[model samples]
Target: LGNQAKAAMNAGDLVSDDLIMGIMAERLKEDDCKAGYLLDGFPRTIPQAEALKVMLAEMGETLDCAVEIDVARDVILDRLTTRRTCSGCGEIYNVKSNPPAVEGKCDKCGEPVVQRDDETEEAISNRLNVYNDQTAPLVGFYKNEGLLLS
Candidate 1:
């Protein structure tokens, strides 16, 4: 799955729906999910949402709600682009909000804190375009299903 995902991402595409649904189906069978689970950044498309409905129905369950964090694209771009991660400790910092004590250095491990390749302005802009084209529709889909919580 990692290889497939990497390939897709490298090609500037989302992972195939089949791969995601298969993983989700198996994951939902886990003991912890029998009660309930909080899924984030999933069901990004209407097809996936429908697949989830079928999957949950097969398990004799139903979705309660879908939460949407409606952030503006400019805000997302600014926030994500400003994020820096420690190479050693994986600590996250934001240049605009919570910069490291020593600029470009991690306080925890003294490692370089750098912006991730995927968090670059170009990369984030491309991701925002993809989200608008593909994932944004899910908001209306969930709303029509009476499952949206914005």
Candidate 2:
């Protein structure tokens, strides 16, 4: 999953569900996550959510809720397209909101800060399209399970 993630991101593609689920299963078994963990953007599809249910059941755990922070699509597009990251230190910046002191340079690491390939407008649009098609249904899936907070 680790190796495939970079290639997928570079291609503006989602990682295969099996790879993600496998990694997530292993991760949830770690000591730190044994207590609990916040999965920011996960279980994007109904199938993944179902897999999570089975996985958690096997672990004697259950998800409390799924929180959806709804933002306007245009706002999401603008935010992602303007996002930048430091090549060295991975500091985040935004062209509109939070820019580095030196243009195109990381304020902390003095390394080049540039837009990620996956953050390009076209790439983001593609991602949003995929999300709309494949991930949006999870809203209804979680809602039906009484675990959704939108």
Candidate 3:
């Protein structure tokens, strides 16, 4: 599900709710997700969160909890700035922290790796602004539902 969102993000664009929902619905219906699944990088918007509730209700399932890792924003900036992306496969690597086994090449796909413009400081600042505006509210939203764990 995150693949589509990642493709959108890699191009410096915010993924639309429709694209996110489509992929999420497909994954959630799969057999592997029946027992349990750990979801990350989802419900980035209030609409997505609301729609997820409706979908889960239809499936007779509910989120057990929403775990938030409360990291400082500056730390995120420092870490994300070093990220590089694979052109063939959208795998991410942090040059200084988790470099690929082969420098400038994807370890999994053998593709040329390059830094995404989206991870530039200015671009990351823009994304952070959007996160603050549209996504931060989710923390309180889930907290009110008694499903938030930090």
Candidate 4:
């Protein structure tokens, strides 16, 4: 699921249920996951969680826990607002502390580093608002199932 999500994110697309489920199906067949596997950055929405539940049920498995990384909205906004990306290599950097070797330049490709329009405070705030409104319920959903750990 992490790989699928990373691929979708790198392709500038939203991670969908089909992609995540496909990844999970493939992973569950592997010997390493026969016992257990820890999930990170998955089940971002209720629908995705439900899809994962169905897949796990078919596999005779269930989630043991779900943990939330608690961070303040202001900190998230600060981080997002300071984020920059290499125009050529797509390497992300933080302007606040992790600036490139050459200011406003890509350390890997020496290309100019640019702030994405979506990384602006306004855009990030809007995205956070939507996430809180639409996806925050997953916390309660997991809690109700006694799977929420933090």
Candidate 5:
């Protein structure tokens, strides 16, 4: 769903929560998910979380736990601000923490490392704002449902 959302954004289209939910519903019907599956980037919003509950109820399953990885906003900003990617290989590196062996060069192919426009401070802050507005409610919703583990 994250890739779908990213693709939609890159294409200048609105990503519908229903579409993402539909994809999740389809994936849940697969045999592997019948036993169990770890969802990394689904149920991002309260509505999606509720939709998931209904879907799982229909499948005679319930969520066992949900974990939230906590990180400081400043840390996120700092990390994103320094992120650089290789245009040739699409390999990502961090200037401050994990820079390539040669400055501004890709370690894999010696190609120039460039900062992705989306990784800029302004773009990152905008994305973070959207995340806070839309995705934050799932934390409380899951907590109320006793599904949140941390």
Candidate 6:
């Protein structure tokens, strides 16, 4: 779903709410989610949240709570700025939190670890702007539903 949305996002456009909801609906029906599951990076809008509630209700399930990890934007920016990813193994490392054994190298694959294009400051800022614009409202929406737990 992420890759499906990336092109539009890179063009500074949002993937339509219906498309995101459809992807979520299909993924939720997989065998892994039969016993309930935790959702993150989803339900970005009030409608999406409401639709999710209805969808789960149709399956005789419902969201019990929503968990939010509160982090400062500056901190998030700093963290993303230092992340290094390996193309060979797709392993990730953080310079501050989880540095590799050798500088500029992937410990697992011996490949050069590079910052991904999307992790660049500009790209990260764009993503943050979109999240703040479209997804931040969910904080209030979930709070009103008494499901927001930060």
- Give the clashing pairs for model 2: none
Residue 127 Cα positional deviation in candidate 6, in Å, after optimal superposition: 1.6
Model 3, range 86-150, lDDT digits (tens) per residue? 99999989999999999999999999999887799899999889989988999999999899998
Model 3: which ten-residue window has the lowest total lDDT? 12-21
Across 7-86, the per-residue lDDT of candidate 6 in tens digits comes to 87889787988778778888889999987888878887778888898888897887889887888889889999999999
How far residue 109's Cα lies from its native spot in candidate 4, in Å, is: 1.9
lDDT score for candidate 3 against the true structure? 0.89
Name every residue pair that clashes in candidate 4.
Answer: none
Q: Relative to the unseen true structure, what is the C-alpha lDDT of residue 63 in candidate 5, on a scale of 0 to 100?
A: 90
What is the RMSD of candidate 5? 2.5
Candidate that would win on TM-score: 1
- How much lDDT does each candidate structure score? 0.90, 0.90, 0.89, 0.88, 0.88, 0.87
- lDDT-wise, the better of 2 and 4 is 2
How well is each residue in 1-150 modelled by candidate 5, as lDDT tens digits?
Answer: 768878998899978978788778888888887668899977778888888898889978899999888888899999999999998899999998899999999999998999999899999999889889988888888889888887
TM-score of each: 0.89, 0.86, 0.76, 0.78, 0.86, 0.83
Superposed model 3: Cα runs more than 4 Å off: 1-14, 86-95, 98-113
Clashes of 1: 0
TM-score of 2: 0.86
Clashes of each: 0, 0, 0, 0, 0, 0
Q: What ranges in model 6 sit over 4 Å off? A: 1-14
Residue 31 alpha-carbon offset, candidate 1, angstroms:
1.4
lDDT, candidate 2, residue 39? 96
lDDT value for model 4:
0.88
User: Which of the predicted structures, 1 or 4, would earn the higher lDDT when compared with the native?
Assistant: 1
